[model samples]
Target chain A: MIRSGGLRLDGVTVLLADGSKFTRKLVAQMLAEFGVGTILEAEDGETALDALKRGPVDLLICDTLVENPDGITLTRMIRHDNGATYRSIPVLLLAGHTRQADVIRMRDCGASLILAKPVAPKALYDRLAWIARDPRPFVDSAIYAGPDRRHNVGEPPNGVARRQMDRERFADQTKSSVSHDEIMAILRQADSL
Target chain B: MRKSRFAALATRDGGRKRSDAVQAAESQLATMEGDYIAEADRLIAQLNVLSGAAQPDVEAIYRVAATLRGLGGAFGYVLVSDIAGSLCDLAERLGAAGQVDPPALLAHAQSLSLLHHRRVKGTGGDGEAQLCEGLARLVARWPAATLP
Candidate 1:
């Protein structure tokens, strides 16, 4: 967690879990320019765990293929820890691939954000700025503030029917919850073919 | 037993299965090699701009050299890895001392630059090859973590 100080800019401590010395240095330099005072480096997961034990870290920036304990497993450990200090810290996972499966896996591992590696300095700075802002509560309305507003529609005046009709027009909405007997009958019909 | 069952499954393999396994290994190796070449080329280009005495960022130089040393061999560029390792060692020594002889460092940087140029042109000499070999030998003596 970041300690509150008199400085207008927040004091951020970053833990970098990357095997690439070049990338670590570049990130350290960039964060320094962004007013981050404390930057910890770990070339592998084992060292990263050691660093975590040394002090309270505000943010963790980890590479996907860290030596020994990989980034996903590290994130799981952080998320599952009973300690308040460890659980509250945000994790940002970095990887070379932008594959959707990789992003999904990182998210499932409790990563707050996923960044593709070879990141530009400006983009990195922007992400840091976002992380510096006060984190929203998990159950906050902000989580569902997306384009999928139809899910929120309720009965009558809320236009639930209209939304349901629109959804049904595009695809079968009730097929997933059909009764087991109905599904069996359908399977039987298919078997006859 | 489970072990006996597993042995029975293993016995089902044929020549086609063996060839498929070999092909998979070859493909994986090729993909890793391609990724290595791309990353090395990018790092080499970045090194060209930063390798000079006038620059005061010792940590950055050490970091780049260290990464090259760690990754070059994995990517099949042992020569580049070896030279980078030597540079990292010198950079670390300079960093610890908090001061460096700029002229000497610049000369070393020049040599590295020349090697990079020769590698690019595919005309590296026996001396360059020997320098790379010497660097590799030096790197073998240092720990991976402290070098970067």
Candidate 2:
């Protein structure tokens, strides 16, 4: 719940999960610079889970290939299996390369966002800011659970439609309409011209 | 079905300006570049030894290459990251088949070492391009394991 003005990152506690110590150090450094209050490091899913159980964290940033359960599995656990207190916190997954299959799995795993590896500082900061202000609601359905996958509030107006159906729908929805009076006035003007 | 409102609540309290935070983070990354390079060099050395072994542990090579790929780009070493990524894919393919392509694996190790030694940052020059092209061809020659 970022306030209307903006939310400061200070006092935010982040749980970082990655198998590589160097990666952990890099991310921790970034979080530190953002004025994050506490940064918990976990080398594997087990450790990450343990950390979650130990205390509440403001965010979870995990690498896709984290050991034991892996990041996708970990996120699923948090969304479905973990204690109520830990289930809803934002989960950001990091990946080196996202194959199509991986994308489907990642989406289904309930992550808040999946940032590509070697994430720039600006990208990370922007993602954090977005998370702070994100209006997406949590969805707990039979087959899927996580933040609502829909990112945009509504269809992009006059922009490239994302899908074939969207293009048709947009065309139909945005088709111009004229009132009977306007039509009559245009006809009268045409006759006068 | 319900908006958590948790993230907003969690973040409502305090923090610095966004620009200041990003600037601070970038500044810190610049300071840490030297350390990353050192670590990258050490990993490349380890890859050299592992790739040169009698058995040539492809799994060990993959681990080292994965680490390199993970951090190389962040420190402005895109060439290192690309070569490391290729190396990881190669290692995975070979490991899946229960086989070893010593020449292909060794080539990647050598390329990484060469890039690190030359301090090639951000996708190196023509020669490095040729090296990368050769590695890509080599990787393409070997079929990747079918994803399940």
Candidate 3:
């Protein structure tokens, strides 16, 4: 029975990975304010992986440009190479630039959500809320393994559009506004097919 | 994926209001403004030093500029973010070619210095906007496809 006073994150353990110390501190502070119980800090991808292996992490908030394997690579590794528990956790990738190319890479790598850098509290809150209620299924395939990319909140076109007419028909429904139940139903039907 | 364990915990009843939580988080950012300014200053200085180097590390400049872009916008220094974003574009293009254009590096470094020195914030005036536009134009000269 979920009663809503606000978003309760007091029990969530977030792994905050970023190369820049300042960036990490800023985000960590926000997470603390949100009442996140345990916030783990990692400077790079390997350290982040180590943190994941050491114990349970509820969510992963990572920077796209974090050094070594980088955020995209790290997410890919989690989806493809890590254990089942590590593979399916929600991953929020923070990027400095949301350029088309960057968005493509982030999407292809299996991030649960992608946020632009200098993250605002409201945006962060909304994204976290969505993640909290996220109903997207874990997709395991040869080429891609993570949350079903076809169903995402802030997704970018990954060159998989269904030509001109289909796009025009659904142009009115913004991608981000798609409801969680709607996406789950769609994914369910997709799985059936 | 199944409902994340985070969801189960987060969606539990009893939590602070969203507005209150956001206000608290923003207040924390406000308190960090001074530190942000100091860090931005240090990064700008580092950029200037890199620009003066006989062979400026284009990758380093890109990384620094990327940092400035990320920081400045949060603190309402929109001009700093915009200019630094341009610098990142230029540096990335140049770095791919293994070329070091000191003048281009210095131009961005000087622009960042001017903004920081005058304490310009939030896109400044039309002049600042034009300056940013020019920098963006300089960046566009080297298209991503051309470099890649």
Identify the candidate with maximal TM-score: 3
Q: Write the per-residue lDDT of candidate 2 for residues B70-127, one digit (tens) a residue.
A: 7877777777888898988888887777887776777788778766776666554555
Residue B29, model 1, lDDT: 40
User: What clash pairs does model 3 have?
Assistant: A137-B1, A138-B1
**DockQ of structure 3:** 0.19
TM-score of chain B, candidate 1? 0.57
All candidates: TM-score = 0.41, 0.80, 0.84
Compare candidates 2 and 3 on TM-score and give the better one: 3
The whole-model lDDT of each prediction reads: 0.50, 0.74, 0.76
- Candidate 1 structure, TM-score to reference: 0.41
Which candidate leads in DockQ?
3
| CAPRI band for model 3 | incorrect
Clashes of 1: 0
Q: After TM-score superposition, what is the CA distance of residue B110 in candidate 2 from its true location, in Å?
A: 0.8
* Steric clashes per prediction: 0, 7, 2
Per-model TM-score (chain A alone) = 0.63, 0.75, 0.75
DockQ of each: 0.01, 0.13, 0.19
lDDT of 3 by residue, A81-190 (tens): 74556778889998775443465677689888887665667667767877777778888889888888677555432222322222233234222322345333322332
Mark the regions of model 2 whose C-alpha exceeds 4 Å error after superposition: A1-7, A97-103, A150-193, B1-6, B9-15, B145-147
Q: lDDT tens digits, residues A107-183, model 2?
A: 79999877766666766776776766666777888888888887564421211221222223223222113233532
lDDT score for candidate 1 against the true structure: 0.50
